[model samples]
Target: MTRVVVHAGFHKTGTSTVQHALAQNRDALAPHLRIHLREDFDPLTASARSWSVTRSDKHFAAIGRNALRFFRSIGREDTRPVLMSSEDLCGHMPGRNGIAAYDAAPDILRVIADNARHWFGPALDLVIYFSTRAPDPWLRSTWWQNLRSTRLTKDLDPYADDLPRAADLSAVVDAVRAAVTAQVVTAPLEDSAARPEGPLAPLLDLTDVPADVRAALGIPPPVNAQPDLGMAEVLLALNRSGLDDEALSDAKRTIRRLAVKRSNLSPHA
Candidate 1:
C-alpha cells in the first residue's frame, strides 16, 4: 500500500517554500522518503510528449488531468510516502473563483471527493492539510502574494481587513472535511515558526521521516513557519510589474474597492 500526501493549498500558505525545500533536498530526502517534487510530478520531462502548458487556462486543464494521472501512476511496491503540492487545486473548480456551482456547494464538495477517490483509490488514507492564519493576516499575505504573482497593485489597504469577508476560506475547509477523510489544521503565520512540534509533527510523522533526516533538515518540532516578508515583497513587485496597463488598472480598482469595503465594515473601524 502506497501512501500519498496531498498538500492542497489555500494559496499564500507557505506551499512554495515547502516545495522549494523539498526540491532542494530531494536527493537527501529521498533516502528516507519517496518525494515527488516537479512541475507535474512527471518522471520524465525531457520528451515533447510532456508538451508543457504555460498559459494559465491551458495549464489548469492540463493540470487537472495530470494531477489524477500522477496519482494513478504510483505502483503497489512504492511504500514511501509520496507527496504532491499544488495550491491552485484547493480553489480551482469551474464556476466561482475556485468553486463551480455543482447544483449546490455540497455537490461541489462531492466533486472534489470524487476526484480524490479516483486518483488515490478507495483504500488510500487521505490527509488534507490547510495552512491557515487569522483572516486579516492571511488576506494581507494573499493580497501581497497576488501582487507579486500578477504585478497587479500595491495598495495593501484593500486586504487589510479582508479576513472578515473571507467566507470562501471557511467554505473550503468545511467542504474538504465533508468531502474526504480529512483534518483541518489551523495555524497562525506569526506563531507557526516557533511552535514547530505540534500539527506539523503529525504531518511529518505520517511519512515516518526519521530523526536523523529531520535533524539534517533542521526541521523544528512544531514548525510554526511563516513566509519571508522581504522575499514576498520582491515577488509581488515583480508580478505587478509584469501586468499590462489595462490589467494593472483593473487590479488597482479591485484592490481599492476591497480596501474601502473592509475599512468601512470593520468592527474596529
Candidate 2:
C-alpha cells in the first residue's frame, strides 16, 4: 500500500519554503517520494471571488485523477509515498476578512479523502499535516498575501488596530483529527526560522524519509516573506487610501520594495 502525505496549510507557515525545497530537490527525493505541488496538479482546485466555503466537486475529482496517475507511476514499488500540498486544503486561504473567507471547515478534508479513496482504493494511507507560527507575524503576513488579490481583500480592514480573533490551533487540530482516519501531524514553526532547512526534519520524520538526506538537498532560499512591522503599518495605511485597484496595487508594490530595502539596511535587520 502506498502512503499519501498531504501538506494542507495554515498559510504563512513554512509551507512555501518546504514546497520550494521539494521542487528544487525533486531528483533527490524521487526515489522515496514524489511531490505534487499545487500548480503541477492544476485542474485540481480554484479559488475565486465567490468560493466562500470550499472547493467544488470538480476540484476534488481532479485531485482524485492526479492521485491515480501518481499511484501508477510508482509501478509495483508501492513503497514510495505520494505527496500533495496545497494550502487551500486548510480552507483558510482568504481567511477572516479577506475575499472568500474559508472558515476552517474540517469537512473539506472528508470530501477530499472520499475523492481520493474513489481513485486509489478503499485503504489509502493519507496523512494530514499542518504547521503553525506566532500569531502576530502569521496574521500580518497572511493579510499581505491576501492583499495581492484586491478582489478578495478590497474592503477588509487592518487587523492591527482591531485585532482579529486569535486562531484556535487546538480546534484546527481537532478538526483534522475528526475529519480523517489518517494520521494527523501539526508542528510549531518558530524553530524553523533559525534553521536554514526550514522544517524538513519533522517532514522527513513523517514520511519516514532519512533525516540525514536533508543536508544533501541543501536549503533553498526563502519565498513570499511578509513585510517588517514598519512596512506592515504602511501597507495598512495604504489599504485605506481608497485608490482604485490598479493604482493601489502599483503603490503597494512600490512601498514593499522600498520598505524591504530599508529593512535590509538597518543593523537590527
Pick out the ten consecutive residues of candidate 1 with the lowest summed lDDT: 44-53
Candidate 2 lDDT by residue in tens digits, 172-211: 6786688777788888788765665676556676777776
Model 2 segments beyond 4 Å from truth? 47-78, 92-104, 147-166, 194-196, 260-269
Return the TM-score for candidate 2, rounded to 2 decimals.
0.77
Number of the top TM-score candidate: 2
What count of clashes does model 1 give? 19
How large an RMSD does model 1 have? 10.0
* Cα-based lDDT for every prediction: 0.49, 0.63
| Total residue pair clashes for candidate 2 | 1
